[model samples]
Target: MTASKTLNVGDKAPDFHLPDAEGRMISLSDYRGVPVVVYFYPKDDTPGCTAEACAFRDQYEDFKQVGAEVIGISSDAPDRHARFAGKHRLPFVLLSDQDGAVRKAYGVAATFGILPGRVTFVIDRDGVIGHIFSSQFRATRHVSEAIDVLGRLA
Candidate 1:
């Protein structure tokens, strides 16, 4: 696999289309003119992933209040995503990056070249990346970091 260049603040957020939990296509471009929080996680139902997802779900209203959308991406299949979301009552979108293409495009490195990396990107309404937070272990912090950035973007 080709190594994806690490993206940074001020870079243009890469556009992507992936299936949501329901097998419907969702595109980054579809949220144009609206800020978006895109988070990459390792898997669904795992402890760390679940904590990160639920953290986002709990703060989902704050994101929406700021006119931002929260989206979670993982390599899991759509069916798994559906079950995970339903189980946790996640209020945001969970996308299936079955082939890891979108994750690579975002340049989310795997932790120690093994587990999938945990990273969060905040994209402005114009589609420019405004902030990026990467932490392999501190999952819940991703939500607060994204919210803090969005608050500043307001």
Candidate 2:
């Protein structure tokens, strides 16, 4: 399949419907009129991923205060996401993008064509992307960067 074009600031965020850890369907349109932070990570329970998730968990209230919803996506199954979220007490939704369809739609390129890319997108209430941050090695920074942009949007 052809790679999807990379997303950029000011572009409309792609809408998607995916299952959360509990297997309940979630749609991007469901979050319309509120800012959303969508982050794609490589795997569940990995060191960097854990750190990144915890960082987001710790600051979840801040995001809520700004009226933004945070969502994490990975190729992991819903059961794996459930375990990961439970293990870390993550307060946000962890989505199962098992086939990486949403990942490709967001243009999250895999690292070296092996590991999945770590990228975060902050979409404004109007559905336009406000910021896009990608850094496979600096996973935790994704949380901070997204929050920073949300602060501006707020």
Model 1 alpha-carbon drift over 4 Å, by segment:
1-3
Candidate 2 C-alpha lDDT tens digits along 21-128: 999999888999999999999999999999999999999999999999999999999999999999999999999988888999999999999999999999999999
lDDT of 1 at 136: 87
User: What's the residue-level lDDT of 123 in candidate 1?
Assistant: 99
Give me candidate 2's TM-score against the actual structure. 0.97
Instruction: Give all TM-scores, in the order shown.
Output: 0.97, 0.97
Identify the candidate with maximal lDDT.
1
Q: Residues 63-146, candidate 1, lDDT per residue (tens digit)?
A: 999999999999999999999999999989899998998999899999999999999999999999999999989999999999
Give residue 153's lDDT in candidate 1 (0 to 100): 98
